[model samples]
Target: MTAPPATPTVAVRLVPGPGAERVRVLAERAGLRCGGDEIGPAATVTVIVAADADQALRAQRTRGPLLFVCDTVSPEGRRRALRAGAVVVGAAELTEAGLLEAVLRAAHPHPSIPYPELSGVLSTGTRPGGPPAACTPALTARQTQVLRLMAEGHANADIALLLGCSEHTVKNVIYELMTRLQARNRAHAVAHAVRHGLV
Candidate 1:
């Protein structure tokens, strides 16, 4: 007998909020395949999208993976979201593909990134149960812009076009950002940026 196709691992929950329906339509259009609670095994990751951060918080049940889609996230809101262990992105400029990519990362994290997947670098405790090592390297303005775009789920090429620069320049800036953040990869850099509220 042939094996059946596997169900998608993550269960996505789009919270009701301003522009949420639009975002949901994008996810659907992007063909973001996901499993739900009723599937074979319960989904390990839960991606929640909303225009308001509080909508996400109210919708969260446990410390599962949260994908906050909003226009702006306040410092205090960022702090609260970090405490809740969430990942965020700016919704105003989101595209279907951007949303898809972010969801995929939240669902199936890159091995290069630190565990407890979405936890920021400055969690109250360290990895496996503590905080990250002290790391506050200063970043250049270009690097900060790149980091913010990266956090918003923009790829190097996209960043380049959006910033009116060459893709090569974008890559170089990202390299500098990764080094400065002491991040292993792009996703890691974003996590650090989010946790530190640098972006």
Candidate 2:
């Protein structure tokens, strides 16, 4: 039988600017080829520019699976970037390893939101105004229950017991949640869910 073709690799786009050198170094360290030209059909794009709000806005419009690295981005700036299509945003201080990991995540999101500690559990019932800020359509009732338990500091076993399900089932749910949220890890998934009111 013929073997299947290799999947296309994610292309990396490096935004132009004084900080471009640093981005280049990071990309090299990660073994990712640098596309010195404008954004094209790359699976991932990284924008390195002066730490300015306007630059952040421009970077946000580049393409899918985008990452913006700079000194600091305001909350509004982050929101704008997210709205524009950036999957990750951080300061230049973020380590090359961290940036590489973030790129991998943007390329292949996790399967579920990280479970929160039991102490952090919050009510999932709809609030007076509407649904709790962190509940998204992507999350099933079981996944939400698992997330709530995680927030409360419950481990997978504990969550399984609380929900009367198998530990393996709980793990699967968490995986699904992380993937649907496009989170890199449990913490990021939880934060993303909370930020978007899709927990």
- The numbered model that scores best in TM-score is 2
lDDT of 1 by residue, 1-199 (tens): 2222223565466655577677767766666544445433344445566645666777776545667776776545555566456665668878776676666655554312334333343343332311334545667789878876776667889999999999999998988889888888887787666555565
Alpha-carbon deviation at 141 in model 2, angstroms = 11
Model 2 Cα shift for residue 191 (angstroms):
7.5
Candidate 2 worst ten-residue window by lDDT: 111-120
TM-score of each: 0.47, 0.52
In angstroms, what RMSD does candidate 2 have relative to the true structure?
A: 8.7
Number of clashes found in candidate 2: 30
Q: Give the C-alpha miss distance for residue 174 in model 1, angstroms.
A: 20
